[model samples]
Target: MTTKNLLVELFVEELPPKALKALGEAFSTTLADSLKASGLATAHSAVTAFASPRRLGAHISAVRSQADDKPVSQKLMPVGVALDAAGQPTPALLKKLGALGFDAGAVPQLKRQPDGKTEALFLDVVVKGATLADGLQKALDEALARLPIPKVMQYQLADGWTSVNFVRPAHGLVALHGADLVPVQALGLTSGRETRGHRFEAAIDPVMLLDADHYARQLLEQGAVIASFADRHAEISRQLRAAAAREGLTPIDDAALLDEVTALVERPNVLLCRFEEEFLAVPQECLILTMKANQKYFPLLDAAGKLTNRFLVVSNISPADPSRVIEGNERVVRPRLADAKFFFDQDRKKTLASRVEGLAKVVYHGKLGTQGERVERVRAIARAIGERLGGTALAADADTAARLAKADLLTDMVGEFPELQGIMGGYYARADGLGETVADAIEDHYKPRFAGDQLPRNDVGIAVALADKLETLVGLFGIGQLPTGDKDPFALRRHALGVVRMLVERQLALDIDALIDTAVKTFGPLVADPARTVGLVVDFMFDRLAVSLRDQGYGAQEIDAVLSRRSSRVHEVPRALAAVRAFAALPEAASLAAANKRVGNILNKSDAPPAAAADPARFVEPQERALFDALQAASAPSAAAFERGDYTASLQALAVLKAPVDAFFDGVMVNADDPALKANRLALLASLHAAMNRVADLSKLAA
Candidate 1:
């Protein structure tokens, strides 16, 4: 029972930082799955990846020896014996066994019990074990040849050369199982124990990787590339943080830039650089963005929390003089900030109000119309959402902000850098002498640029945000651009989640359905087809909301039951989901679900609605009378509680009826011979349905 370690490294030209991070994870998971499917489960198998802008490498551990043969058993019955008295085996049993490759003699042997009344048979079918290399090679080759590198190229010269391309040209590959090289080749790469290191810094020596532990150390000292992304990333952060701390400034925590930095260097060398103190006169955000977006430098600030004219940059190579490196980076960053400052100065010359008219020429989408038209639609929808939330009059600024929010998208500043979309608009709004509220709304409207980003704080901001998200969702879905799988071309999923957060976090009394309806109507004239837009909006948002709810610990079945009712209200779904969860928590809840199922079952079988209420004069059973009186009392508390959103109270009230329900079912026959008694029992079950339906259709939940 010897274990083998496998190492595979692909050195390539510089890859996009984001792509490298994702590929590392995908490679590891896919490798594990490939191993499992190959029937090679050793004590442990893991994929460890090392990524830089230049290369991506994976090291696997304890890759099992050839898969071991396992004993398999097959049940067998003679064709004649499998047949019934009709002289044929049971058709289902015969077909199943036949498809499983069963033969009478080859089948597993079975014996009769002491009773010896029935015959039995079985077969032990021994499968030949495969060499671990046999399975491992195929899995490795297929994974390497068709790895999940979304973008690839073809790189073969003519005349039978291996010519597959990936994220970048695969220069060299190191593949090994223990000390032996596994015989697999792809993309002109032949599996071997030798690997190349530090594409630019180290010699192209034939370095042999003998084992996982040894392999890591060799790559660290002689190979020159920190093959572990996690190790490299931590080292970069440590150096960057220390350098920034020496200058009495805090490093801006940018996860995106951190990832990029991880890809940019091998042996990270962090150095602090400074710009002119006067540059701090520019907006803090502008300076930070210029450094991060333009130069990929980590911005540093002083203890007073002000920009210190200092920044930290990580370099792959440790230069002869670190001072020279710092100066060189400063030289590059200075002009980028100057360009930003120039854009800021030029943009402030014209007020956002004056520039607002410029949106008419900016096409948002050729099919959806101009930015100006989109603004109008956003304003109208925001106003509608505001009114729905009981803030109709106070929402005036929201309308104004929505009208000018996209004005900056046409401004020279935004044109130079589209990432500054709403941000540039906010600056222009402030320069135009608009009130703080309007400018802030414009800025905060896009506050949450991505997942986990801060949401809008003001009602006006929330309204405009909702309007923007809904319009995009409805417009795209109307044109059939809905997100499928990872292909969210328009980021519709993020937008939908934004709407959900707005309602839940801001506690906005928004009926998502109503807002979606308003959005659909506002775009009705613009959309190619109006009828499909409404349904698309509803289904799309429900899907996004379902994901959001599930992340919040809601059961899928409960979400399904609540959403199945087609409740357009976002605020209510959470409440309904809460009620369903609480109802489920009841000791009697499972029994109640089962009870409702029984009721549904009986109704389906009867295929008839309950009979008319029993005539009081003909009411003959004491149990029936008690059930009727209890139903009247139970309906009051549950109905009142449900109306007030007191779902807990409603469920508690329902619990009071569980006892009576069980007793009535046990002591009383629902289909009694007496028509009067039968009607009363039917009325009782119908009453339960009405009460339960207020919270959720409990029957839809699994018992």
Candidate 2:
């Protein structure tokens, strides 16, 4: 029953930075999980993961040396087949007992239990638990096998003839249970207490860990390395903030950049480096991106959030003077910044208008023609959308913006940094003497690109943005390239979600179906069935909208009720869902919803449509007459409120129908013997159904 903390580490060549965090977590969790599953670790054991550029490891607490032995009852075979008629052991029983390492004397101890129509013999035995060494070895093997390795490298081991595959060349493997080294082997290395520290700054060569819990402390003290990835990242972040604060500036906040830098260094020493102030003449985005993406540096920002010439570098070694490190980083970064400035300056020599002609040479997709053709389609769609939103002025600006948008793709700045496509376009548009509206639209057209991202700043931008997204969706869908599962090479799902977000969040009055139709028409003979394509695109958008609404904390029933109506104006969906939520809270909501479902089923089964109104003379039951009167009273106000956009009030108004509806169904037979009576009842039910579902399909809320 003795337990001890366990530690395991695998040291190798530098791992992929982006995959380090995931790899660390997966290795630790998988190792601990495998141990627990084998009963060598308790459920309450604590596990801590450590990862650096060169290693992945785990520290687990309260791991038992061996699991407890348990008595197990295993069914052998049917009693009839195991024993003779005289209750003596048959050859089958003797053979089964012999296979289980039991002798003939053990046959009398077998138990019988009825299993369906026959009795089965069962054997009870004690199962020995796995030893710590065996369990740890198994867990380590499984963990390595299950690692999320981005790529694998095959290399020969020291034996020269033997080879191994791993994320990198494995140098060492450490596995310790408390103070003792557990006998485990992995990646062509045996378990040991020795591991290398920082490549250049280790206090000692082949740092030796004294105990299972001393791995981290020894690494930091003697190895000159911060072994834990999270701790190292936090330390780097702290130093960066402190260094920037001393200069009265703030370091740019980028989690991805932080992680990549953390992975690149072991012991982080923050140093402030600078470039020529003249480089600031280029767009801050250009300089900032060059520093971060190419050099893995954090660009400092002034109080006004403007990029400063000074930047912070996280170095692996800490020198007493630190002057050489600072100067080396500055020298390395100058050319990158110069390249960015050069691209920007060279790009301005030729206007964006000149680059428009070059787009014809760039292929967008094999089936979608050239970028020039796509730009024309986008311009047409944008013009149509702009005219619908605001007359000729907006249309002209949108068309101009759309035409110039793709021109930046050929510019030096964008060619060097593809992420700056739309941004550089906006800059070049302004330099061309185009007005603010056109420039802003050019940049903002790619707005709301992802979830929670901002939408277009102006009506012109909105039109252009909508047009761009619609063109992408319709074009790809027409080519039978619809997104299947997770393989959306064209990002169709993102494009669809962008459209839905703009339509619903902006509360735009545009009709989704009509917009899709317009977009499809812009493709000319490329699309086969414009009408069917419209339906497919609309359905796809609605599906994305439903998922989005659910993520926003709306219930499935509420979303279903509103979307089930197939409301073409997505802007009204939120209001409809709100109304549904309010109506569902009413005491009579359940009955009314159920009654609405009943009415729909009856109408669907009918061969003819219900009459427009119920005849008073044909009403035979008092309940039927009462329901008709209630319907007349509720329908008028509900319809008026719905027209005025008071969806909540519209739905609430139908609550009055619950009693009458329930009573009519309970007391009156809707399919009466008389033809006129049955027809009249159906008509009354139809009117009631129409009144209740003005905002959403109430039947969806029944459950």
TM-score of model 2 (CA atoms): 0.97
Q: Model 2, residue 539: displacement in angstroms?
A: 1.2
What lDDT would each prediction earn against the true structure?
Answer: 0.74, 0.92
Clashing pairs in 2: none
Any idea what lDDT model 1 has?
Answer: 0.74
Q: What CA RMSD would candidate 2 show?
A: 1.6
Q: Write the per-residue lDDT of candidate 2 for residues 377-436, one digit (tens) a residue.
A: 999999999998899998999999999999999998998899998999999999999989
Tens digits of per-residue lDDT for model 1 on 84-153?
6874446655556667675443223433222245554444667756665676667656666555677777
Q: Output the number of the lDDT-best candidate.
A: 2
Q: Which stretches of candidate 1 lie over 4 Å from their true place?
A: 1-4, 24-43, 53-56, 63-139, 156-164, 175-186, 189-195, 199-213, 302-307, 390-392, 447-449, 527-532, 598-618, 667-684
| Cα lDDT for residue 652, candidate 1 | 66
